[model samples]
Target: MTLASGLTLTVVLALVSVVALVMRPRGTSTVDFYLAGQRVGVATNAWAICGDYFSAASFLGVAAAVYATGLDGAWYAVGFAAGFVPVLLFVAAPLRRFGEFSIPDFLGRRLGSERVRLVAVGVVQLVILSYLVPQTVGSGITWELLVGQGVAGLSPYATGIVVSTAVVAALVSFGGMRGTTWTQAVQFLLLLGALLWLAATVIGEGFHYGDAVEQISTAPLGNPAPDGGLATEPNALHPGEPAVFGEPGARYDVLGQIALMVTLAMGTAGLPHVMNRYFTSPTGSAARTTTVWVLCLAGVFYAVAVMLGTAAREIVPGAVADNPWLDELTVDGVLTVPEHALPVLGRIYGGDAGLGVVAAGALIAVLSTIAGLLLAAAASWGHDVYERHLNPRATQRQAVRAGRITTLVTAGTAAGIGLVLRPEAFAASTPSIVATMVTWAFAVAGSALTPVFLLSIWWRRTTAAGAVAGMTTGVVVVIAMLTAGTVADGSPWPDLLLAPTLLAAPLTTVVTVVVSRSTAPPPDVERSWLIMHGTAADRHTQALARLVLAESRRRRREVRRARR
Candidate 1:
């Protein structure tokens, strides 16, 4: 790495460490450790949520997708941004109103069954592991490009995975959710700022976005072939036609587009890490407001990503003549690894310093996301599994300790998995493997957890047996389809298999309803609904906060009078 790049990365990591240490939980209270004492404000939580939500997938993968597939790649950004809508409309308020430490805790309590909790815990862990691996993979990819060297006798990729996981594991274990919250919020701002800076720099260099898109659309879409050469991808929608940069058929057809969007949208509601953030909100109303801010922020971030991707498509080829280093990274003016789009653009526009900024943003994205996933895993294994089932009378300190241990184990496991799975092995199959892998996680959550989660909230008749049955069916069907898709490559049903949420989610819902009809509902369904849908808890929390603020103000006034 260049001196500027190394210094930039070091500074960013230092800032993150300082923030985590400064915001570490103050007590042994489980609530404080896991949910930040339920005191995080809406705006801060929203930024942290954005940090958690926009993983390496958003920072690198989305731009890479747009760089490779053009219009089809832009859909990844759209779907990602749209995913929050369901959370805002159906999930945020109710989920916070019925506050709990994790998804499994909420479901287990709502359904009044240990069996349900255990099953949900299993599904949640699967989701977290799936999500965690991608963040590690992204870190590895960034390290491969940024540092270009490994430490401790490891390859650059492996080194990246190990270092990132270790640093983030330590942060989460020490800081818990409170420390993580502040760090994530800061990380997200830095990420946004990096993108904005790159955008302005690019646009200032006479890059007309509209003209660029129109100009780039004139040629057939080309990517690196398996044989280390450029090849034009055939249009899936228009059988004999060549795919173009501004068109849709470069990647997905109509069904594929819809399926991908639906999967991502529904998956947001079921994501354990993201949903857990809602529990940190002071009130249900604040959670709802947080979602609003998240939507607005995410929309801006993705829009810029899409624009930058387009700019890269138009700008990179012309600049390749000047930068000799670009030869190996590109084939016939097209990037071999789509994820390198933003970093490459950074180098082209601002040299090593610019590359450092974007690369640091990418690493921060991975770090922030991994922290959230680790905390979510800790909540599941430590709180839901160890404390609740293994030792019901466990002290708060013990539970918190268990959570820290879980964080380390989970991070280690994910790093191992990331090492085993090489991005180059699957690069030929998708525009951005990091983005695609994350979408699979989304598919699992959407299919297995979201349908059941939504039903348990909206349908009183959703019995524990029904939920178990639905979750099992969703997991089975999604896995089966994904496995079949891998084995049956080039099949006409690739879209359906790749994004099985459309099929799996509906099927899971049907199974849930069918099983629920035959089984008895929870006895406390009315009470659960009152807690979930009712606004009384929100009002109560708001009143308490106002009272506390008023009392503080009165005390300050008295102190001032005494001084006079």
Candidate 2:
């Protein structure tokens, strides 16, 4: 790592911290602290939502996966972008219209049961921590590349986690949702700008995307793996021979491919952080618009990430002899870890300064994700558990205080977990370790929360008891399946156990519907539907009414001033 790169990362993080603090919400209400006072606009919220979704998985992991697996990795980008379609078509409007503080809050109130809230809280926390750990781990990995040393004799990885976790925790505590929203929006743009810059530079160097794909796929997908690195097997995409980058089965079988796509696509509907962002929208229609914008912005971002990965496959090996850094990371022109794919490109293309910019982008992605996760955790605990159940008479100030405390605790716990789950612990065998962990979270969310959530909105027969049973069934079944898979890591049934969402989600839906049939429905289904399915004209007219009220208030103030 170069001093120039280290300084750039430090300066950039400091700026983000300052800006978020400046945007910190003044009101101490639950809405102010947790959902940005429900006042965020479409464009800004859309960008923030993109930043929340991207994580280190999209910014770093996707590229590395593509570099390592050829065409198989492109599916990850597709799965991620496609996930939002379900959110837009099914969940976004109703969720925003029936706005609550968090997922647990929504579920609890929708079902009129504190028990449902408590159960949902547990699942939400599980998902958040599952999501948070990977972001924290990604921070350490990026730091290891950007700055090789640790502060005060700590390991490079540990130092990275501690510093990043501390800074992000502080920001979440100080700024709340309002601060996080602004910071995330800015972070996403910066990340996009970095990708665009690198893409432009590569294209100017006469790099052809098609040529790179053909060249890499022409043989089997291969990269430099030093003595300490994990060994590559025969290409899965190709089966018996070296796999081409354009072929299927490069990394997974046909079933595995379908499973992966289902896990990721349905995952968005249940992600606590992403759904919470919708609650910040001014109206349901605004939330729908925001989802549309997210799809557009995210498409451009992931497309560039995929291209960078392909280009890096060709760029890095040739630079090995010329760049000393390559010697440290590569063996026989192959990268030690696929995660090094993007950062190494930055150094080759623009030296330390370029490497610094990309590294900072990686860190920014991690930070933005951690912020969203921490806030989601806070909302789950403070609004759903504490305010609603523990302290029914609590003031807004008290509620905000509880949320701030929870955010700190959640952030710290995730950092500690991240420190324990070091890459070395995993033997650095999988370069895309962060993505793998994130996929677990997605699987859990899609299975446990999403199916039940959609049912509650669209099927009025969904009862509190059915929701509880369905959610519990989903969580328990998916966890059991994932655990079984982990134990049988090298076994033949790997793909099925590894990504059980395709089975888990359908099972959850079945269990929910069956239980609902036996349980009593809510007495006021039409009332809930009326609130959720309000038309665009209704939304527009409501907005006009609010505007009129504000104008009349302003006129009255002016008349009072004239009389004085």
Candidate 3:
């Protein structure tokens, strides 16, 4: 059965590669490679946006978090869905309108400073790498479960990390953004379809969502003990009390709540991979429209994810108890590995095929995200750094080659880091390490880039120095606090430092405001402001008038020639 599932995974990866090959850029220009020549339409870009945004964290991590923490875990989903709101209202259209190949490129040109561009490239790479590692971890987890074997003494998890990274790196190098965009859009449908089918099947099997929540609520959430044999442990949200499912505070404190939401919501706007896709839209208005569609699909995806998590809370334990082989995976009523909740439920309901579909969706989530991340990395390194600084006179082919090489290097680095982390070793009853790691990336991006990004767009006073200061403050505070929290042993510091956006974001904002007041604005501020905020309709009208005037001039020239 595992072999059969592995075969399914192979076929899916091959198909995606073929799709990338078909959509591969026909030209060698950076525009063609980085932005798909800015030709993608609204609907396709929306799906690709979903594929980019809904990584392993959203697909498997969210459900697993909910399974472990009850309604408290659903905060991840809520934060994720709510994140798109800020993107739509603030960043999407204007970002595309002021578009470049990547965020670093935009900030560099906007600020009129090469230093600002270089600094942004460093931050964007950090954000991308932070985001990429979790997807690789997720692929390994899915592979370990579905394949149940490894090659040449390597762990199945390690094999998965290598294979998934290699495949996506090839796709980005071969297909570039155009190929990756098409594949991502299609893969997202596969992801959404898989989630919907499983959710529907379980509910139809007399699994009451309300009852599942109520039953779990009556007892404190207890997860399988870390010792891994037969012991079980209680994961109480309140030290001595059972946590309820339909409410807040089960997984977060008030500070945690505010920090998580702010980080997730604002973080969406600053995600390098996510924002890079906006440049692919054919028009600024199309980018805005694409975000609306993303919001719709994301709402559906996460809502179904929450329901499936609740279903797992009811189903997997019972199913495991009836089967001897499941003992290693679950102890008593608790799952040893909370991340397996979705796949375990798939097997329980629709048998092997269900398991394969669900498992493949997990890999697809990883693949789609890795493709976008790799592309973002390429843009940052190749366009933002290499082309901008090292090779101003380089040819299109040379730039594309540089980007491909960067993609491979970035993919390898992420895979190497992921293997080192071995995320499975630290899994627990609470939001698993994979989910928590993702929040770190979001927190840093939000605290550092989001505030400065938004201020640069809306405020006329924002300067290059301010942008750099804000981002630097954010990066330093987030990394320092998260490191201290990880090493420290305590309640208040860990909780607050773990989700530090509440503290770090304000600090970043202050630095940005103070620095901007002291520094002068970019010299092209008036023109840049017009470009960023001009109505899409105005551009459309202007383009149409230009075309009409050109045609009229051509007609007059023909008449004069005929008269002569």
Candidate 4:
């Protein structure tokens, strides 16, 4: 049925996010619009970060990957969650300490380099766009399956992308950070709830996880071995399953797996939208705390997704085709669209309303992520470009106006890209398409920008030139890979997990250090350190207030001593 029951749940989620936007206090200041006046608390900000980070990939892709492969797909979740560990240890607190609206702001002011800011801005925009389009496409694919209406000269896929993008843009434009944060926190909880609920119901249905694994192990995963060898379907439940493991593809090696993990983990620090949330925290310490919380939240959610993927394989064999939307999207009985697995299972277990809820949650996931990315784009353009470059004399109101304009423009640009390369079905399934784009972004950010940011904050020797060189090398390598047909379908090595990042990131760091050693460092590197690492004024004020109270107690003791 159109607007499947599970989709109804999704509608409620979207409505709730919208209500949050409408009910939030109108923002009047730049700080409020950009960083929610920097007043977000630790727990709330952490949850919001989870909402932003989860995205379509975590919610849909993780489960789909597991369902497609066996245990190997679980690596996606592990890699994604592990990225936060580095963020907490090296990046989060220092990032907030700088008190910038976006990553470019921090780098620009820290190095007093306008060129650095511009380059950073360009990279940030590229990464954000790359990340944003797939999400829009994912939303469209989901809507097509759930709603089935080709409205306004658009297919269901296109309609989903437009509607979802518009909703997020509206929320970000009107509600700003305050409303967006609250909605995202709530949405994350709902997403977790949906995942946990599905897991519980699946387990309760008496599906044995171990038994399922053994059952799967019996088959030739995705394909069989030919002539009783690995060439033909080896076993029905084992590696013969081409739909899951690329039955017709090559197996990845250990080095490749390590590279994939490194790419994802290091790349966390470079994601523009996720980094933007740091500005919302009250202090660096709070941002660190938020990362810790996010780690826990991500751990639980990912584990559940892995379990659900296994269950989907065992419980509903050929269930992909039974669902109305799945029939259109799947290739034969197998899912061409791995992203649809979890949502399809939701319908199978919960009926129409269950499907609606899961679908809506998926939509909400995209909406929240898009809103965050759009805001990051706005902050980068408005603060870094219009204010810093074009109109240094502009007032706060003017800056806010610039920000709004940029938000609209960035959102439109992202939507345009999503439309131009939009896939007919399972766009994400293509080896060099959605997944490749995402990996390229990760490679760029991790290889170039992340190392510089970490060294800038931690190592005293990192020069401004070093930072620029590193970022440049990283971006150039990743871009070249993307354009060079490195990841084209049926390519031998492109599908390897670390084929891009593992090779490119080290080159970026080497270039950075080499260039840095040859050039004189910034004159006020010490002063920049103070600015980036120093405690916030408000935090110091509170400390002084506490000290004064302690002094008063000491004075009373002295007076008592004198009198006695």
Candidate 5:
């Protein structure tokens, strides 16, 4: 099985490399390297964004959360899928219309302040690093299970981290956004295909979804104990009550649930990699259309993930007697590490081949996301920092070279962080550490970046000073709350503190508005607003497209007459 799995993984990586090489940017132009020449169509960008958005957190963590905590875990998927809605409504079109390389680029230019851009770069890097480390962690976890061997004296886990980061960094550095975009789009299809295959196999095995949920609900949820035994979890919502598989209290309480959802939902608008995909659109309308497709596609992907999580809970326990490997992975039918639920299910129904498909899917999830994050980091450092400030007169080739260097540095940094924080140290304390860490990134983005991002677009009075202050305040408040929550783990209000977007976002908004009112707006505020909210650019793009279509039709008619 390990050999077969290794072969499958090698094939997937080879195919990804081929795509990156084939689609590599033709020139060193910043536009080509960073935004794919602004030529990515609606469908391709939609698929790529889905690939970027659905990380290991979405692939493994969501399922693991569901397998571990039941209904409460389902919210992770719900929140993740819901996050796109705000993007569609308030962000997608305007962001593209603004026409900048990244979030920092847009904020800096819109507010007419270099200080705003630099401050935004700082916040965006924090968000990217926050998001990047977990992906490396997830890769390590998957590799540890799938291969179960080490390279060069490194543990299997460390090897996974180092290998994944290196491969993805090289792909991003060489292929740039053009190559990365196509590879990501293809990878997303593969990820979805793997999930669909698993779902079909489970259903074919006479598994009934509703009945399974009801059956599992009959018993209290049990997790792996510290002593390598089974222990029932207490309900956080209802103290003294045993957590149930079909209920909400297995992980978060009422307030915690709301906070988690809000953090995730609003955070999508602020994520640098996800939001940067919007800039690759040819027009604002195309960006909006791409987002619609993303919503539909993401909806299906997450729904399937939720179903599989439920399926794993129902089926794995009963199959333990038949599969010897299950003895070590599970405790009395429950997975010791909930993230293993999908891979274990794959092996049970499909044999080693099935496990290969699922394991490859997990690695692809991590790799695709890592590629996007590295690109985002590169754009920030190369375009935002080096090109704009360090050497304003840098040539196009120099700028692109800087981006490649940034990608390598960022990947190395993330890998180092992943190594320092081993999974064994925190696995017992969290339901799905991948998902939880991702939520923290969401909390920071929603609290700090989202409020200011929306304000800069919607509010004409938004000043650079106001935006800076709001972002700074948001970062400080979220960090303080998260730290306090960690320190006071057993307290009732820890849920709110841990997922602090609910508290941090509104306060940030108020601060932004108040500060903006007190200060004079940017001198060209009206012009920026028109560019952001007006349809002039969309209209021009439509006109040009019509002219091109007309010319093509004329040429085709001429060829037909000549043939006759």
Candidate 6:
């Protein structure tokens, strides 16, 4: 069958799922609607977390990065996966213990400051919107490549934007967090399975990973020759040879690379959607366990993604006219679609059926991620703003309605922005889609939120005033830097703007510290410190696990005796 036939079936199946999820009734309580009644199993919640975390970045961008930049692009996966380690070790358990529906809610309660809450909500919303728009862009690009359809009067890109936003908004509005979590978990597994299968098939076809990497490393990174602009040949390698962009020992600037890595690694704790997932776990232990699972799952997925990326770079020749859609996008007969490299590999290895599965998985990646972000955005706007500030007397149903409305508004706004800006498609890949957008989100979150959160949890003297001051300074700096670097084309900033998180975050720490020293610390800072570090809760969690295990053993023994 044709690729179009397979793609059509995939789209049909995904859309039909909306009916079953939306028809269900939402419960009255905030917990029921937002945290899935706090009964989500560890394994399920882990999958959902992966779903929320993967985004379009993981499905398309990672492979695309690999195809385009070789090992350097693999750092995207490393930074992303490493982000969770901090979340698990430092953020997840305490965050779950806080038992809030969203990060803004948790901060509002922890510091008892409305002003802080408001500021956080605004920052959270910005982060969500920034992240959301790119995912929509990614969805559009994927759909255009896969199905070749553009709904009435809309470009294929616009069609993707409209369809993805509508579907995700509908799912979120109807299901709330409860329905969304289940779908997200299932979707994550499907996404990973697709990645795994694709990787295995590539390897099974006698693809040599090491040889492929050597070839890619030997080739020049970025556009060849005139388009790529020349520099001095490296002491270690030729000017055209692929090398890190910054820092010593590495091909690139090491400091710059580490900065990007640290920003992502630290920023995961502050991301509203990711932070919100901790609330869905029933207990702190469950939250910690979820992170552990995430570590393992992410490790496997990223490793495979790098391999697939290397294989794509090696197998997919630079020639464009040989493949469909290559000529339209490729400059000077070379396929420029770095993102398409992976999809092409899918078609080559899996044929039409494989391409369909991979495409559908990519859609699921965007849908699942957008669902989580929209829910988080809704929680910030609906629960934090509408319910808490506007209509304090809102009933559970009314609050949920507010959440739905917020979801629609947020999704619509993101879709509209994507329709307008339409991320630049490079070569064969959606290079500017999910990953770059997500990087912006990380930069903002790292710069604005991570410094304050780390200080708040670790430093006893961290005053509410300090937290507020620090976050504000960070957010403003990050915005200014990014705006100047990206929007103001004539700005003097170095190409180092490619990684903004490095500069934006440390300045935030300095601002926070300088401000905190001048202000009186909050009186309850000691209590907050204890909550963050004291071990009583950890002991209780361990005891509870033992008790549950003992009970299960007793029940098994009784059943055995009865049978005998």
* TM-score of candidate 4 against the unseen true structure: 0.86
Overall lDDT per candidate, in order of appearance? 0.93, 0.86, 0.86, 0.74, 0.93, 0.75
Give the lowest summed-lDDT range of ten residues in model 6.
229-238
State the lDDT of candidate 3 residue by residue for 1-564, as single tens digits.
466676778788888988898999989999999999999999999999999999999889899989877777888999999998989998998888987888888888888889989988888889999999999999998989888788888898999899899989998999999999999999999999889989889988898888788877765556655665433232233454445555555667667777777878878888999999999987788999999999999999999999998889888767765766677777776677778889888877767778899999999999999999999999999998888789999988999999999999999999999998765466642477778889989988898888888888898899999999999999999998888877776646466788788889899999999999999999988768878896767656667877999999999999999999
Model 2 TM-score (2 dp): 0.93
Model 1, residue 342: what's the lDDT? 95
TM-score of each: 0.95, 0.93, 0.93, 0.86, 0.94, 0.86
How much is 185 displaced in model 2, in angstroms? Answer: 0.6
lDDT (0-100) at residue 514 of candidate 3? 100
Better model by TM-score: candidate 1 vs candidate 6: 1
RMSD of each: 7.4, 6.0, 4.4, 7.2, 7.6, 8.7
Give the Cα-based TM-score of candidate 5 against the true structure: 0.94
Clashing pairs in 5: none
Question: For candidate 3, what is the TM-score?
Answer: 0.93
Report the error of model 4 at residue 246, Å: 14
Candidate 6 residue-wise lDDT, 341-377, digit = tens: 5667777666677777777788888999999999999
Show how many residue pairs clash in every candidate, following the order shown.
0, 5, 0, 47, 0, 21
